[model samples]
Target: MQWNVQELENWEELRTYVDTALLPLYLYRPEKPVKEHVQRMSYLVQVAASIEQRLKGRVLMFPLCYQIGDEPLAQRLPAGFAHYVLLQFSGDRLDAHEGEGSRLRLTVGDEDLESALRFEVTIDVLSQEIIRHWQHGGRQ
Candidate 1:
């Protein structure tokens, strides 16, 4: 969990690795229910783990993070819906001033995602598992 200046300087490169790693998860979208959400998240984790191995210098993958109330409706309604996609960097490394550092607001959504609200709701439920693993260290 050490980030040296040299590695930090190449912030764009680092961010690319981050983006490249997570993009796939959202591209295709996953199956129903939140259980499969982890598969998508695993895509992001795999990216970070891969980057951690090849890159040298400073750079740490903090821990997975997700928020329960990114959307007002989801929070207030308390009904079934897709939750927000949480973006947890290894301690906000994505916020770096590098070229295009990690997305300021991290969200894992598929590229060809349906242009509908329900799809979003689906992503939310599964997000809980992502947060759980980051905090407790286990699969969904």
Candidate 2:
């Protein structure tokens, strides 16, 4: 997965990564009704659209809408897929490293991040980076 120091070179690559890596992860929402896919997609759109604003000049965002098959990757999609609809980032890469779970090497910096919350909020509560910063004590 080694990300060469090239993503930050321009906006095109940033969009390319999102198209290639993020879209397959959750595009269709297999659990939802066909009619609901549009609503689901709209929600995903709002989330994905925010990255550029939050990150400012640090990262560029890809498209919010992508079409994907309505099934899990292991059963229908295949291996090494984008896994659905996902927002992607591209920027100047620093280097590559062994990732936490997969064999794919990842580049350093925000460009390498693949947080799906950029597309939805369900997992946001558990993100360690967020939790660590947000957790607080009450009258304990």
Candidate 3:
């Protein structure tokens, strides 16, 4: 599930099955070129949307959160879900540490950015990680 009006309409009913929250983290470099930021964020968003589709009933993907200053990013998330998955580019500036629940870091590195096949592989790896989190009872 995603953070859209359609998906959130039945929040009360979906709340019980959705125990994980997927938050995409990206760096916001104001001085950088606009195109660069858009390209990077677009890729991350695509990857996240695919993941949410694969794990629809169990995960709710939040919007992309771009880090501006040195503040903690994970702190932005509410304290409700059983697990929080931080999706980000491997070389992004912010490395958020979750203070609550089981936190999982799913990164997409340069090597994984080559083509559609690579992106699919990245998604597979990330999906496995999330499944592993559930198997371990939402532990590290």
Candidate 4:
């Protein structure tokens, strides 16, 4: 399920199966080229979409959220889910809040990450982590 009109309309019936919320986070630097930022953001969204596809009914994906360089992290996380997964291209700003409670900050492209293979690898790792979270009953 996803955060959209159709899903919300059937949320009353399908909400029970959705125990997790996926928030796609991307970072943008004003000084950088527009193309670069767009590419990174696309990758972040692709990751969130892949995870949602892997988990199917267990996860609800939110819109792409972003942070500007050096700004404080103050995005409002989604509510009413047993787990919150923050999917982002690795950065220091988000690292501070990693592993707080049921939130799983799964990141890819920590450094100079180039290649589709990296995205697939990250998707697998994130899917496994979510499965483990479910197995543990949503505990840390």
Best by lDDT: 3
Tens digits of lDDT, candidate 3, 31-138: 878887788889999999999999989999999888875565655555778888888878665655534778888888855454998888888999999999999988
Highest-scoring model, TM-score = 3
lDDT by residue for model 4 (22-136), tens: 8887777788899888777877788888889999888999898778787877776666777888787765455324333487777777544477787788889989988988888
RMSD of each: 16.4, 13.4, 2.2, 2.9
Error of 4 at 41 (Å): 0.3
In order, candidate lDDTs are 0.35, 0.32, 0.83, 0.78
Which ten residues in a row are the worst by lDDT in model 3? Answer: 69-78
Q: Could you tell me which residue pairs clash in candidate 1?
A: 3-58, 3-59, 4-58, 26-110, 62-90, 81-121, 82-120, 82-121, 82-122, 83-124
lDDT of 1 at 95: 21
Q: Which of candidates 2 and 3 reaches a greater TM-score?
A: 3
TM-score of each: 0.31, 0.34, 0.88, 0.85
Ten-residue region with minimum lDDT total, candidate 2: 99-108
- Model 4, which residues run further than 4 Å from truth? 95-101, 110-114
Winner on lDDT between 1 and 3 is: 3
lDDT of 3 at 125: 91
Worst 10-residue lDDT window, candidate 4:
92-101
The digit string of per-residue lDDT tens for model 2 on 1-140 reads 11234544564544434322222123453565876655555544444444233433322333443435543333222133221222312221122222221222111123213455433343232122222322321010
**Candidate 1 lowest-lDDT run of ten:** 73-82
